[model samples]
Target: MRKWLVRRALAVNVRVKILGIALGVAVFLGGATIVFLRGYLVRVWTEDLRVRAVEIARDNASRSTDFLLTNNLYELYALLRGAVDGNPDVRYAFVLGPDGAVLADTFGPAFPADLLSVSTVRVADDAEIALLQSGHSRLHDVAIPIYDGRVGTLRLAVSEDRMRAQIGEVVAHITLMTGLAAGFGIAAAFLLTYALTQPIAGLLHATEAVGREEFAHRVDVQTTDEFGALGESFNTMIERLGVVERQRTELLKRILTVQEEERSRIAHELHDHTGQELTALLYRVSVVAEAPTLEAARGELIELEKAAARALKEVRLLAFEMRPAALRDLGLAAALQHEARAFTQLYGFAVRCHVAGLGEVALDGESETAVYRIVREALMNTAHHAQANNASVLVQARNHTLVAIVEDDGVGYDADAVLAGPPETRFGLLGMTERARLIGASITFESSPGAGTTVYVEIPIGAGAAEGADDADSSPDSG
Candidate 1:
């Protein structure tokens, strides 16, 4: 039942939830206040009523002392009647003889015999009070001795109806005030809900805009609080996403451009070098076929064989440049060494290659290719741009991970500035980053002006490789 209630409450919108909370608080506090005030007022008013009754009875007894002592029955009856008529709370007043006989009473001739037995006060006593129930009304019967009760006693009864009526009026007034307070509380709750939900609504709309690929959408920050900070964070995320999208588009264009350039270079090599060699071999073959003597034909056949060998070598070199055979035959370690040696010969810079613990690490085919291409790109950048004289490539396996580093002792340029530069200048670095991403690896570059550049690559190589790679890719330095 508790779980159901929680779920039901959570299912409501923020505005409804806030309003419900406010209403509950107002009703609880208002009801409590009303009950407390009602009880307090009743106690205070009841005490006041008792005190008023006693005072009225004492005053009547004191005034009637002379009337009773002189045996003036007319004056005494007139005095009792005047007391009853003058005060609305006094129900009736009467004087009794010392022998318990009724001397005078406001009831006149209809005075009941039971009235004498209702209350009594001794001659030495000051006053005595007793409660009497007369039909539906309750009365306080106060008895006081007149002249020390040597003459007679005065009996006065005060009704509680008037006090009850006043108490009812007070309770009604308090209830009305409580209702007004509740109304005001509800209005304040509505304003509070509006202020809170407005920012949430803005966030929801901005999220929807992001879903529709509207990268320019922004949230309006209105306060210096957590909500404002959240808006700022969301805007930062959108801006970064926009940057990534633009970089992806430019990277695609650069890839296509690089592919076309490589294809053109290959085509030119085939036509100018291999094509000429093949054509010369073919002409020598015709010469051998049309030779007049066997000696002439043997000589022509030697020249044709030489031309054929040169063409084969040219074709083999072109194929190696496209996809190295060593990579498939001897694995990643041997392939990197072969590329390093080739780079040293072509670029006139000594390139050293080192490998360790690679036999223990198991890398998938795509992962191996990505690492190789990334290292190759790093070396190319160092040779062409870093003005490096000596470079080294290191590949090692450590704790279920494969790490590679390419370092060059050259005049290094600022890595951040280069990455943020024009697309054409940063294609090599961007291409290496893209390759690492495809293989679930992370790559980073450390370089500054006049300092040697270092390229770092890390690839997970065990059962938890995918998860580890995801963590690394999400890191800030992974680019």
Candidate 2:
């Protein structure tokens, strides 16, 4: 049941990781596109407002010029005064004479007298007349040179801040609209992805269920789509997988039962027949082989002794390989160190083992078997496959778990490619990963084409580790 959970969690992690990438790309592109379009629209909107303001200015100037020409100063002054409360954009539409004096102003005396005097003083050849300064105020003074058969200048100004306020309201509305559009766009993308990938998610869940020996769980989505067809085919595949799993379980039980029965028979035979024969042979060989007489037979006797010793070593090696002397005698850390040094000596591969906080820590039998075998297999593979000159191993506490990292500066193969190979070919990885999973651990294999390979194992330390330690601590000789 725990193994099943890890598979499901791994599937979800992969999905979320891929989805995160897609979401990131969507946000970046969407925001950039919105900003670009908004900038262009704002430019057009501001220009439109500017043109309309200019038209209003020209109309007011014409009226001021008419009043001045008809000698209606009272009417002209009233129009200028009334224009102040008209809008914040039209600052002040009043007159400025040839002298440096304001003829009339809607705003009080704080306004500059020489605001639009430059235009009235010197005549120019243009439609919309402009002043010299771009102020931060609400006043923009423009002049209209009268062409009504006189040299009179109709000086006028409207509030620049008022025009901006009007334009800003439009921009504010656009900003709100852009925000709403962006929100809608993001929601649509999320929904579209969820709808599109739902079938894939279901397939993943089914795969995880099957991996954990849950035979009842099957894909049954019925549709004409590619995913639906895959689901149907996958259901058939799961059915066949269930049969294989049952057969394998029964076969493993039979094999274990037979192996135990044979070991018992061999133990008896060795104690009775072979043990006595070898003892007598050793005594016979030793008695004559040590005698200095019969030189010709002496060489053959030495060979016999050598053969006997070699046979004994082979038996011992096989017995120990079935388990391990140190693993049975000492704890997991000591056993690991012993194996690491042996590997360096026997295979000429430099291996380092560093232990910390392992004084009283002992691993359960199953976990010890898994971890030790993983390290052993890793070393063996390095000796066979990794064309490395040097390697290192570090085991330490990381965060909430114990982490073991094995790294080699070898010509590393693609980790994904190796993991994806046939089950027979990836038996090493399968053994390590399956064992790790059974005990709530995680194994990560990382490699690059020409860089190196690193295998990391994270085991949670607690009851699970201690459960097997007692059994694993049985001395090899005691057995």
Predicted model with the maximum lDDT:
1
- Candidate 2, residue 351: how far the Cα is off, in Å: 61
Let me know the TM-score candidate 2 reaches against the reference structure.
0.42
Q: Could you tell me how far off, in angstroms, the CA of residue 136 lies in candidate 1 after the best superposition?
A: 8.9
Give stretches of model 1 more than 4 Å off. 1-5, 61-73, 92-195, 252-329, 345-348, 383-388, 399-401, 409-412, 437-441, 448-452, 459-479
lDDT of 2 by residue, 346-460 (tens): 7776777765544335456887777778878777778788887666666654344667788888898888988766455555666667667778999999987888888899888
Which residue runs of candidate 2 sit more than 4 Å off their true CA positions?
1-42, 45-54, 65-72, 82-88, 114-128, 131-139, 147-151, 160-163, 196-202, 205-211, 219-224, 249-479
lDDT of 1 by residue, 217-302 (tens): 98888977888888888889888887777788899998888799999999999999999998898899889989999999999988
**lDDT values for all models:** 0.83, 0.66
lDDT of candidate 1 vs native?
Answer: 0.83
Best by TM-score: 1
